[model samples]
Target chain A: MKTVSPFLELESGPRVKVILDDVALSLPQGANLAAALLAAGVPVFRDTPISGAPRGPFCMMGACFDCLIEIEGTTRQACMIEVTDGLEITRIHHDEALA
Target chain B: MTRSDLAIIGAGPAGMAAAAQAAELGLCVTVLDEQPRAGGQIYRDVDRVAPLRGDILGAEYTYGATLTASLKHSAITHLAGAIVWAIEDQFRISYTRDGRGAQLDADHVLLATGALERPMPLPGWTLPGVMTAGAGQILLKQSGVLARDAVLVGSGPLLYLIAAQMVRAGTPPKAMIETQTRSDFISAAQHMGGALRGWRYLAKGLKMLASITRAGVPRYTSATDIAVQGTDKAEAVSFISNGHTQRITCDTVFLHHGVVPNVQAARSLGIAHTWDAAQQCFVPKRDEWGQSDKEGVFIAGDSAGIGGAKAAEYAGTLAALQIAFAAERLTREDRDRCAAKLRAKLAHEQAARPFLDAAYPPYAQALLPDDSTVICRCEEITAGDIRGYAKLGCIGPNQTKAFGRAGMGPCQGRYCGLSVTALLADARGQTPDETGYYRIRPPLKPVTLSELAGMEVTTPDAVH
Candidate 1:
C-alpha cells in the first residue's frame, strides 16, 4: 500500500530522518509524527492487550489515546508530538507502558 | 512558583483573545497549552503551517494567523507544551512543562480548552484505519498529508469541510456515507430564519457542499447501519443507503457527528453544568460574561459550548473586559461599552448554532453501538459489558466505573464518557443526565510522581 499520499509531496519542506521501530524514514521536519508515520505506510501503532487488535491514531488531538506510542522511553501521543531528526519511536503493544 | 493576574488554560481563539485583551489592559497574563504552538485545534499550527500550505486550510483558518501574530506580540507569558494537571482552590494551578513540574497563582483563570469531536462508536469503529474526521483535518493542517483511499462517514459541517479540503488538495475521499436522515432537514427548516440571520455561516456550508459536489465525489446519503469491515486494518466500509446495502473499498474511514464542549476541566472544578438538549451534550453553566458558577473562574469558547471560533473570541473578550473591570483597570462605563459590541457580535456569531445543532444531531442510535462493539477503547470494555453492569444495578457512570474500569484509562473518559452515560441511561430507561456523567477528579491529565514531587509549593499568604 502506498502510505504517503502523492498530494502531500507536491510541495517539499525541510526533511528529517527518524527511526520508527528501527526502520528509518525521511519525513518533513516539524510535521506531526503520527501523520508522518501514517503517510510512510506504517500502520498499527499499538495493539489492544486483551484482543490484541491493532489501533492507530484516531483523534489527532489529545482527546483520544488511540495514537499513543513509545518515544524516548515514554509513551506519548504521536499526533501531539512533532517529528525531529534522529528521534527514535517504538510501537507500544500494551497499555501498561502508558500507565 | 509563578504568579500572574490572569492565567488562561488554552491558546485557541478564546485564550489568545483573552490574553491579548488582558495584556493590553495592563494585566500580567500567562497562557498554558498542551500544543507546541499557541494556536489551538481550530487554528493548530496556523503560524507555521498556514504560511507553508497557503490557503489549503480555507479562509476561517487564515483569521487565526492574525490572532496568533497578536499573541506573539503580546506582553503575556505564553507557555506552550504545558499540560495543566490540576487547578486547585485559591486559584492555584499545577502544570508540567519540559519535564518539570510547576505551580502558578492567578487572580482569575480562563478555561478555553475548546471542544472535542463527539464519539461516533459504530460496528468496527475500533478498526485501525477508522478515525475521527477532525483527525484527518489535523493531519492536513499539521503536516499537509491527506489520507489515501479514504471514505468519510457520519454527518456534520466538519465532515463536509474536511471532504471539501481533501477535494481541494486533489485527494478527495472515495465516497461520503452521510447518516443524516430526512427528519434532520425538517428540523433544520424550522430554524432556517435564524440560520439565515447568520448568512455567512450558511453560505460557507453551502459553498463547501457545492465544492464537494463539483469534485464529483460519490455521496451516499441517509446511510444507515454503517460498518467499517476489516481484519487487521480497514479494508472496506459497508452501509445501507436507499434501503440497499452498499460497500466501498477504502483504507481510511473518517467519522464525524459534530462536536461537544470539553467540560472535564470545569467539571473538575465542580462548576455547574446543564445539558443542552439542542446540542445533546453537557455544557458548563456560565453568565453572559463567561463567568462560571465558580468565582474567579471563567469558561470561554467551545469549552463552554460549541459556538465556534468567532463566538469564542467574543466571549473571551467579554470575560477579559469583565476581569479588567473587577481589577479596577476599567470603569463601569468603559467595561460596559467594550462588552456591548462583543455581546452583539457574539449573538450574531451564535445565531446559526441552533440550526446547525438540530441539523446534525448525533444519530443517537449510532452512538449506542451493538453489544459486540467496543465502547471504551482503553480498558477494552464492550457495550455489552456496560449493559451488564447496568443490569447489575449500576445507576450512573460513576457507579458503572466501579463495576468495570470503563473511563479509567489513559484518555480519562474522553473516548468513552458519553457512551457509558447513554448506555446506562438506556438500561435504566432514563435520560442521560439522570444517569449522570463521570465525576472528574484532579491530576486531570496524567502526571508522573517525580514531576509532582518536584513541584514548588508556597504558602497561601505568600503570593498575596
Candidate 2:
C-alpha cells in the first residue's frame, strides 16, 4: 500500500511508537490516532455489525462515530484519541458485540 | 463541586468571547470544552497548528490565535478535555475530565456548541473513503493530512473553501461536482444589496472560487443524482450534470451542502426552537442579547443560527453584556452603550447569510436519498426503512425513531436527524417542521456509568 501523507511533517515534533493490532508503528506523539493510522495505510477502521461493512472516520470532529476501535479494552473514537507511545489499539471486529 | 456566576459550554469563538467579557465584568466564569485545545472546530488546534502550517491554513484561521491567547490570559476557568454530558435543572452541569466525574453550578449557562455540516445522504455515502468535506478539512487542520485523489461533491461555500485549501496545500482534489443550478444564482442575486454590506465575505468567496478554477480541477455544475460507487471503499462518483451522465474515478469523495446549528444541547435542555426558512434548519429562539426562552440560559453563535465566526463573536459579546446586566454588575445604560457597536457589526456580518442560504441550499435530491441508500450509518438503516415507517403512519421523527431505530445510534442522530426529517416530510407531503425532529435527550454525548456514579451532588443554595 502506498502512503498518502498530504502535509509535510515538522521535524521537531515528538515521535512515539504505538501498537496497532499487534503491529508496531511510529507516529507523531500528539497527532490524531486515526489520521496517523490512515497515513500509515490502515483504512477500514471498523466494520458495521449489521452489514459487516467497512467504515472509517467521516466527520473527524467527534460528530461521526465511524472510527471506533477497542483501545485498552474500551471502545473509543480513533479520531478523538491522541497518539501516545505504548498505546494498544485493536481493530473492532464486525461480530464483536458493542458494550 | 464547583460554582461559577456563568458556565459556558464550548470554547469556540462565541464561548471564548463570552467568557472573556463576563470575567472582565466581575463575574466568575467556567468554560468547558471537549477538545484538548481552546479553539473549537473552526479554530481547532490553532495554538499548535498555525505556527507550523502558517500560509496553508490562511489568515482567517490564524485570527483564532489572538482569541485563544486572550482566553488563556483571562480569569475564566478553562477546562479542556471536559465532556459535558448532562445539564440538570437549577443550572447543574455534570461533566467528565481526565476520566473523573465533576459537577458545576452556575447562575447562568451559555451554549455555544456551534454548527455541523448538513447531512448529505446519497447512495454509498457510508462506504469507506466517503466523508464530509469538513472531515477532510479537519484532517488537514489537526494532523496535516489530506485524502489522496479526492473528488469534491455537493454545493456551498465550504466546498470551494476546502478545495482552495487543498490547492494551497499542493494536494488539489481531482475535481468538483457542484449541485447548485443557475436558478440558485438568480435567487441569490435579488439579495445582492444586503450581501454587499458584507463585501469581505463575498470577496473571500470569489477568491476561493478563482483559486479552484485556477488549480484546473474539473468542475461539473448542476450535478444531480450524485452517488459514490464502491463495494467496500469509494472507487468512483456517478452523477448527472447538464442533462448528461458523468462518472469520475477517485480514491476519496468529500461531500458538503451547508451547515446547521448544533442544537443537541439546546434541544436537550428544552429550549424553544423555530425553523429558519432561509437557512432551512431549526434554530434556537433567542433575543437580541442571546437569552433563550428558558431563563438563566443563553444560546449564542452559530448554535443559535448559521451566522459565521464574526457574527458568533459579536453575539457572544452581546450575551455576556446581558448576563452582566442581569448580575447587576453594570447599569442598563452602560450595557446599551457597550452593545451598540457589537450590534452594528453583527448586522453587517449577518447581512450576507440570506444570499448564501439561497445560493447554496442543500441539494434536494441528496436530502431524500434513494430507497437503497443508508440514512443512519450507525444503525445501518436505509431510506427505504424510514419511508416504510412513514407510509405506515409514523407521525414524525420521534415515531420513526421508535419504529425503526434510525436515530438511536452512537452518533445520536447528529448525522441523520435532518435527513430523516426531510425524508419523512417528503413522504407525508408536509413541511419539515410539521414532520418535526428527534426529541433530543441528555447525556447529550456518551458518558461512562462509572463517571456518572462518581458525580458529587450539591444543593444549589449550598454551592452558592
Candidate 3:
C-alpha cells in the first residue's frame, strides 16, 4: 500500500486499464468502481451542481446520490458500478462551468 | 410483461426467505434484486466475499448464504441487478436492468427493500472522505477494501461491528467517538427483560467490543457537538467528550447512528405509515403477517422497519405463509401452523431492539445540526434553511418543496427527509406524526427518461 493513498486494498488482482478524467488508470477489473477509485486516490466523485462542492459515496447502498459519476455515457452511482476494461469515467455534474 | 404468482423485490434475507417459503407452497415466485448477487447490505456479496473474508466479516454475514442457497429452486426465479423504480397498481413492478427496462405482474408483491443508515448530518458530512460505517463495511465486503487511519463516529452495535471488522482486517480505527451517554444506558436498562431474552445479540455486541478493546482503539462515549474538520475533503473529526473538545486527525470519517426503514417504495405505493417514536423514523403500517394496508401488497424486512436480518427472515416467511393461505394453495390451519414458529422467531429476534433503540438514539446534534450544517446533501440545504422555512410558515416537508426546494433534488429527500421532518416538527411545536414526511411518488429511484421510454409499452399505467 502506498503511503499517499487514504485507502488500502485487501486483495490483489490483475489490473485493467481505464481512464478517469482522461488520465489512464490500471484499476482492478470487476472490483467495485467506487472502492477502486477511492483506493486509487481519486476522492472527488462529482462536484455539487449548486455550490460546486466535492462529494463522494455516503450510503454506498444506492440510497445516497452523492457518488454519481458518468460511466460510459450515463450518470450512475460509482458504488453500484463495477470496474471494467476501457471504462471511461468522469465527474457527473449538471453545472457546465464546473465541468 | 412476465407474470408470476408472487413477485419479491430485493433478495435479502426477507425476500429470499419469502420467495422460498411461498414457492414451496406451490406459488410461482420471482425475486428481483439490485445487486449482482443475493446478499443485502447486512451481508452484501456473501457468496463472493465470504469465502475470502468470512472470518473478518464474522459468522452472521456468512449465514446469509443459507438464504441465498434456497433460491436455487426452479419455482423461484431470481432477477439479479434489477433496480425497481415503480410499484404500480395490481402488483405491476417496473424495473431497469443493464440499461433496459422491464415490467412484471404478480398476484402478490413483497417489498423487502431494506433499511438505510439514518443520515448523520454534520458540518462536513458532504465531504469526499466522509461516509457511513455501512458504506465502509460495503467496501470491505464487496472489494476487500479498508480505509487507512479512519475514525469511527456515532452510536450503536454497527459502529462496534465495523470497528472490530476493521481491527480484524489489521487496520483498526484510530478512535471511536460515541454519542450514547450514561443517561442513555440508564434509560436502556428499563428494557433489560427483553434484552435478557435476546442474549445472543448482546453477546455478539460484547464480542465485537472485546475485539476492538483488544486492538486498543480508543473509544470515547457521550461525545457531542461532533463535526468533521476539513475544507475540501475530510481531514479529521472534532467532538466534545467529557466537557472537553477533542479532534482526531484522520482521512476518513465513518458516521452512523442507526438505520431506518427504507420507505421510498413503501411510501410511493401509498402504504400507511406511522411515526415510530423509538426508532425515530416513519415506518410503513403492516399487520403481524407483513401484509400492508394496501390490497395484495406486503412489506417485510428492514423496509417495513429496522428489525435486523433474522427478524426480517422470519417476517418474510410469515408474510409468504399468509399469502399462500390467501391464494388458497394452503388451508388456513396449515398456514397458521407453518407461521407459528416463524412469528415466534420474529418476536425473539426483535426482543433486544427496545434496549438498543433507547441506548443509541440518533445523535441529537446530527438530528438537528447547527445552523450551517448541511442536512440535505443533494440540494446543499442547511439545517438553518429548514428552520427558516418553518419561520416562514412551512409546517411540513411538502411545503419545503415550494418554500426553498429543500427536498426536490435528485434523491427526492431520501437522506434528508427525516431531518426535515424533525426540524419542521421542532419548529412548528408539533410531533413528527403531525409534521408528516414527504409524499413519495413512483419512479422512486432516479431513472433516465430513456429507460422509461424503452420499457414495455403494453397496458400503459393510468396517470395518477
Candidate 4:
C-alpha cells in the first residue's frame, strides 16, 4: 500500500542526523525525531518511577509534551524542532530532576 | 512601540468582531492573528491551493472575511503572524516579529487566543500516521492534501465534519469509528432539548449530519481504541467492542477527544479559573461582558468557552460594547440593548453545549502503555519512570519535578502535560482539570532563542 504521511520516512536516507546522549545517529530525512528514534529501535523517551507505566509521544504536535528531550543542553520541543545533523539530545530521567 | 487603545489577541470571529466594534466606537485597536492570514479555525482557509473561491466559503466565513477586511480601513492595526508571548497587568504584551522581540502596550487587552485540540492518548497513538482531527483538516484544507484511506476515530461532532470535508475534497475516510455510543447519544439528545431554545442551531446540526450521511461515511459507534499496529508507521488498527477484537488496515488515523482553551497565557496571567464540569476544561470565569476578573482584561471566542464561531462573534461584540460603555463613548441605553441581545444569544449558545459535551465523553483507555510505552518521548522516559517518580510521593506536577523530572524536559510541558495530568489525576482520583495543564507563556509558537535574547526584557515583569 502506498502511504504519504507528514511524519513518515519515505526514502531510506539520513534525512536528519542527531546525537542521542552524545551518541551520533542518522534519522530518516525530515521525520520527527521521536518517530525516527522509535524506528531506529530506541524505545524509551523517558522513565516513570511509581507504577512504571511507559509513556511516549502521543500528540505529535507540541501540545502533548510527553516527548521532551534535551537538545544542545536546553530542553526544546522535539516535534516543533526539526532534526538537524549533529543535534544532541539527552534523555531525561524520573530522578534526573532532583539533580 | 506599536500602540492601540485596545489590542485583540487573535483575528478570529471574536477578535475581528471586537476590533470592529471598538473601532466603530472611536477607539484605536490592533488585532494580532498568528496565521499568515485571519480567520480562526472554524473559518479557516479551505484549501489554500484551491482557495475556496470567495463564494464557496459559505456566508459566515465570507462575511467574517469581509468584516476583517473592513477593519483594515479602520483605525485598527492588523498584525499578521504576530504571536503574543506575555501579557502584563498594565495591558502590555511581549511578542516576536521577523525574529526579533517587540512590545505593545494597550489600554485594554482582549485575549481571543482561541482553542486548541484536546489531547487524547492511547496505545500506538505515538505512531507516525496518527494525528488529531484538526491537524488532518488543516492538511486537507490548507495544504490540499488528504488523509485518505484513513481511519477516522474519536467521539466528537467534528469527526463527522472532518469526514464530510474529506469526502467533499474527493477523498473520504475508509471508515468512521466513533468512541461514543447510541446510548450516550440518547443522553446527548435529551441534553439537546435544552439547546432547542433556538431553531437555527437545531437546523445547523441536522444540516451537518445530513451532509455526513450523504457522504456515505461508514460509522461505528460505541467504539474504543484497542491498538494501533505498525512497526515504524501505523499500517493497521485493532479496536474492541463487547470484549471482541476488530481490526482495520489504514495508513491514516485521526483522533480527537475534544478541545481545550489554549490557556497558557491566561494561566501565566494568574487569573482565577473555575472548572466547568460539563465542559470538562478549566476556563476563565467572565462576566456577561466577557471581562475576566482582571479589570481591563477581556476574553472572547473559544478562549472563553467552546460555543463555535457564532458565539465567539457575539461574545466579541459584547466585550467591545462593554469596553465602549466603560470608556463612556456609548449611552447607557445603547449598551444595555446590545448587552441584552448578546446575552440572549449567549444563553442560546450555552444551551447547545451540554448536548455537544454529552455526545463526546472522554474515553478512558488504559493509558499506562505497558512499561515500554514512552512517557516523555523527547527525554525517552517510560511509563515505568513516571510511576516510579509518583511512588516517591510526588503529589502534584511541581512535586513530581523534584522526584521524576516529569514536567521539566522541555516543549515546556506542552507535549506531555495532558497525559501527565491525566495520569496524576487518575492516580489521585481527581478530575483531569484538577491536575491542570501547563502554563502558556507567549510566542505561542516556538521563537528562536535569538528572539528571546534580543527582547528588551523589561525585568521580567511579575506574571500577574
Candidate 5:
C-alpha cells in the first residue's frame, strides 16, 4: 500500500556501507538505512517474529510492520528509521536457520 | 517583564476569588487568563445572544462582572487571552498572545487552568455530530448555536444541569442516558449527608432533576454499552439497558463521562501526582495551601483536584491565606480560621464525590470496544493492531515499539494511554491501572521546529 508520512529528505552524499542485523549491505550516500548498515559492516538481512529473526525494511513511513531491526541497541521502524555511517543493527527474535 | 506579588492563571471562580482576597489583604495581584471574556468555562457568559435578564445568566453576569470590577478597584491586574505555556520555580512564565511569545515574572503563582471532559471513544465519537456536553454548552452559550436535537449521555450533576439548560433554551434533547445504576445511587447517597449542610444546594439539584423530568427526556438509567453509529457523522446511538438494546436516533450526541484535570502545565513542571481513582484521572498532590512539593509553585481549584466551583472558591481562599500567612501579612490565627472553613468545604465536596462517581464510574467497557474499534482516531490505529503487538511478546508500550508502531503517533499516547493499559491488562489478566500507562513528559503539545528555534536554551551557568 502506498502511504504518505513525514520524513526528512536528504541529497548529495557519498555511498557508505552499513550492516542491519548483521546483514552486509552497500547503500548510496545520503541513503540513511543503507549507510547505517554498511557502517556496522555486518551482512544480516532482517529480524524474526519470535527468536529475533532476520527482517528488513517493509513500510518505511511508520506504517506496516515490516522493516523493523535493532539499530544501536534500540528497535526502530525501518521506514521511519534514519541511517548514518558506521551504525550497527542487531537482530532479535525469529532467528534464521542458517543453511 | 511585568511583575506582581501573585500571578493567578485563570479568571474562573477560584482565580477571581483568590485575586480578590489577596488584593484585599494589600497584595499586588495579576490574573492571566486565556479567555477574551473573564469567566472560565464553568461560568461562561450566555449573554452573547440573549439579554442578561433571566436567572439562567444571573451567575455569569454577577460573578464575572463583580470579579472583573473588583480586580479593577483593588491592586489586581487582568491579562485576558494570555496563554501561559511554561512556568519555573522562580515564577517566570512564558505565554503566547497575538502570535507573539512573552514572559512575565511573579513572586507567587496560582494555577487554576480547570478541567476538560474525559474523551470516551465510542464508534463515530470523532464525527462532527458528536461533542462533549461541555462543548455543546460552549457552542450554545458563546456562539449562540444549538444542535437541532442532542442526546445527552452519561450522568452526574453536570449532566442534569446541561440537560436543563438545553431544555430551557428551547432546544430540548431527545434523551438523557444515565450510565449510573440505581444500585450505585446508594453509594452516591452516603456522600449526600456531607452536602446536606447547604439546603440551597440540595434544592438546586432537586430543581434541576424536576426540570429534566418535566422535559420528558427519556432517562435510561443503568445503561451499558453505548455505541454511536455513523460513517462520516454521528447519526444515532445504541445502548443496552435492562437486557434490551435501545437505540436513540439523533443528530447529536453530547457525552460527558466525567472531568479530568488539564494536566499539561502540571506535567511540564514535574509536580508529583497520584491517581485519583474516584474521577479516574491523575490529580496533583498539594498541601492545605495548594502549595505543591515544588517550592514557589502552588496549585488551586480543579487543577489541584476536581472540585466544583464552590469548593474551588474555598480552595483559592485557602491557598491565598497560606501564602499571605507565610509572608507575615496575616497572623497565624487568621490563617487557621480560614483553613477551618476550607476544611468544611473540602469535606462537603468529598462527601458528594462518591455519589457522583457511583452515578458515573469511568465506563470501563467503553475503553475496550470491538477489535475493529479505532483506539487512536488521529492515527487510525485499530484495536487489532494493539492485540497484534501483544501477541508478538510486546509487554508494554516501550517493548511494543518493536513489534508495531502503536502509540508512536502525534498525540504521544494521550488518547490511547488508558485504553492501551486496559488492553495490556486484559492480555496479561491484570488490572487496567496495574498495567501502568505512559508517563506524561513535557513539551506537552507538539511545537513546530521554528517555534523551538527562538527558545532560550539553558546553559550550565543559568542552572541557579
Candidate 6:
C-alpha cells in the first residue's frame, strides 16, 4: 500500500501492520503511536464525544487529550502509546466510554 | 511499595539533574516519566534522535544527552514509561506502568514536569491539521516526520528554532505569520540592558533567523487577527500583517505563543501559587531552594516556571542540594557552597526571559477569546459560556465544572484552566489571581480503574 501521509519521514525502517478503526495501516515500529498514524495517513484519531467533531494530535505531549484512541479495550493517548505490531486500535466515542 | 530517599517525577532536564545530583549525595532516588526514555519534550528521544538529527535540532537539544548520561548511577532508579496519576498524602506517588498501577513512598518529592504550549484558541484550532509547533517538533524528534507546506503561526524564539530545523530538514514552512510588532519591541526595549547580559540567547536567535532567511521563506510579521481558515481542516491561515489582510495556503498550521508551567500535578498537592504578570501565568510559589510552600515538596524546572532547559538543570541541582541538606547527607555549608555557582549560572540562563516575555506576550484575544471561539477543547465550552458563568456568579475555574463541565473533562483542564481564569476575570473585572485556577482533581493523567484496582499493595516499605 502507498503512504498517503502529508508528513515526510527523514528515515524509515521496519514496517509493522496495525488495524486502526477497522483499516490496516503499515506503520514504522518504534514510532510514537500518534506520529506513526499520521505517517500512515490515518485521518482523525477520534471524534469529540461532545459534539462529534474531528480531533487529532494537538499537543503530542500528554497534556492534551486530543488524540484519544482505544487499544485492546483500553483508551489511551495515541501520543503516549508506542507503535507495536498486530495491535488493534479503535476510535474512542461517547463521553461515558472515555477511559 | 517502592521506598526511596527522594521520588522525582519526570525524567526531563530537571528530574535527570536532580536524580543524578541526589544520588551522588547518597540519596536513594527513583525518577518516573511518561515517556519510555529520558529527556522531556525539549529533548525527547535524545539518545536516538540526536545521533541522527543532532545538526538539525541543534546542540541545545542534543545537550540533553549529557543529562541522560549523568543518570547512569546505582543510587538512581529510572521508572520509564510510568504515567504518574497522583501525589497522595505523605509523599506517596501513584502511577501506572505497563497496564498496572503502582505506588512509591518517598521522604521527599520533586516535580519537574515541565511546560505546555499555551493553547492558541482561535476558530478551527481544534481541527486535525492544526497542532502546536512543539507537537510538530516532537514528531520530528520521535518519528522523523515532517509536515508538507505547514504555515508557522504566532510568536516566540521557539518558532524561529523550529523553522530553522524544518529548513534543514528540506521542508521549510510556507510562511511565518508572527505577531510581534514594533510596539512590542518598544515595550521590550526597556529590558535591553538585561537582554544584553543574556547575549548567548540573542546570538542563537539571530542564527536561527539567518537560517530561515537563507531558506527564503516568506515572513508576515506584525500579524494580527489570525485565524485558521478551513471548514473541516486547516487549508490556509488568514491574518492581517503590515496593515494588509492576507491568506497563505497550507496543508498544516503550527500554532504557538509561549509555554506555561504544567502545574496540574503540583497544584493538586495544594501548593501555593502566584501570578507572574510578565509571563501572564500562575506559577507555583517556591523559595531559592526550589522548595514549594508545602513541606518536603519541591518544584524545579518549568514545573515551577518557564526557565529554559539549562536553567532547569541548575534549578534541579539546587533542589537536590536542598534535599541533601534536609536529608543530612550534606551540611548547610556544603549545600550552600555547591549551590552558589549553580544559582548564578541559572540566573544567567534566565536573564533573557524578561525581554522575551515582553517581546512575545500572549495574544490578548486568545487569552479571552471572543464569544464564539472554543476555549476548552475537552468540553467544547465556548468563551461566551465562561462569560455567562461569570455573570451567573461563577467566581473561579472550579465553578465552571458545575456550570458546564468546563474543567471536568478527561484532560482535567490542563489546556483550558488559564483561559477559563482569564475569561472569568475579564467578565467579573478581577485579576487572574483573583479569578483563580481550577481545583485540579487526580488521577492527574487518566488511570484505568482496572489498573488502580489491580495494583499490588505490598508491605509498607520494600527497600531494594
Cα lDDT of model 5 by residue, B1-464, tens digit: 67788888888878878888888877888888876556677765422323432344335334555555555645888887565767775777776554355667888888887776665766656554566777666544443345556798876777887787777766678898778787777776776665565555567778888988897878888888888887544668899888889998976678877777766577677777776677777788788789988876678888787877777778888888877776678899988987897888677666655556665676655557667776654455667777777787767755554455555654456556666766776787766445555655544433334444555544323656
Ordered list by lDDT, greatest first: 3, 6, 2, 1, 4, 5
Per-residue alpha-carbon lDDT of candidate 4 for residues B13-111, written as tens digits (9 for 90 to 100): 899889988999898898877655676666654223223433322454456565556567558888876767778857788787655787888888888
Give the top-scoring candidate (DockQ): 3
Residue B428, candidate 1: alpha-carbon lDDT: 89
Report chain B TM per candidate: 0.97, 0.97, 0.98, 0.89, 0.87, 0.98
Which of the two candidates, 2 or 4, achieves a greater DockQ against the reference? 2
Q: Positional deviation of B25 in candidate 2, in angstroms?
A: 0.9
> What's the interface RMS deviation of candidate 1?
2.1
Badly placed stretches (over 4 Å) of model 3 are: A1-3, A97-99, B460-464
- Native-to-model Cα distance after best TM-score fit, residue B146 in candidate 3, in Å: 0.5
Alpha-carbon runs more than 4 Å astray in model 5 = A1-99, B46-54, B57-64, B198-200, B387-417, B421-437, B446-464
Q: What is the per-residue lDDT of model 3 for residues B13-72, given as tens digits with 9 covering 90 to 100? A: 899999999999999999999998898888798988888989898888999999999999
**Residue A61's lDDT in candidate 1:** 86
Residue B327 deviation, candidate 4, in Å?
2.6
lDDT of 6 at B197: 94
Across residues B1-464, which tens digit of lDDT does each residue of candidate 1 receive?
Answer: 67899999999999999999988898989999999997899999888877776577888897898898878645699999999989987599989988778989999999999999898888888888889998888888877778768999988999999998898888889999998878888989999988999999899999999999999999898888888899978889998998999999988999899889998899999998877888888899899889999999998999999999999998899999999888889899999998888888988998898898888778665678889888888888889999999888888898877898899988889888988988888888998767779999988888877777887777767756
**Candidate 4 C-alpha RMSD relative to the actual structure:** 6.9
Ranking by DockQ: 3, 6, 2, 1, 4, 5
TM-score of each: 0.96, 0.96, 0.97, 0.78, 0.73, 0.97
Candidate 1 segments whose C-alpha is farther than 4 A from its true place: A1-11, A95-99, B453-464
Q: Is candidate 4 or candidate 6 better by DockQ?
A: 6
User: Against the unseen true structure, what C-alpha lDDT does each candidate score?
Assistant: 0.86, 0.88, 0.89, 0.68, 0.64, 0.89
DockQ for candidate 4, C-alpha atoms: 0.11
lDDT of 4: 0.68
Candidate 5 docking class: incorrect
Q: What would the per-residue lDDT of candidate 6 be over residues B1-464, giving only the tens digit for each residue?
A: 77899999989999999999999999999999999999999989999889898988888889899999999999999999999988987788989998899988999999999999987898779888899999989989888999978999989998998899999999999899998888999999999888999999999889899989999999998887888887656788898999999988887889999999999888899998889998889999999999998999999999898988999999999999999999999999999888989989988998889999999888766887889999899999999999988888887889889999997888889889899988888888888888889987688987788998989877565686
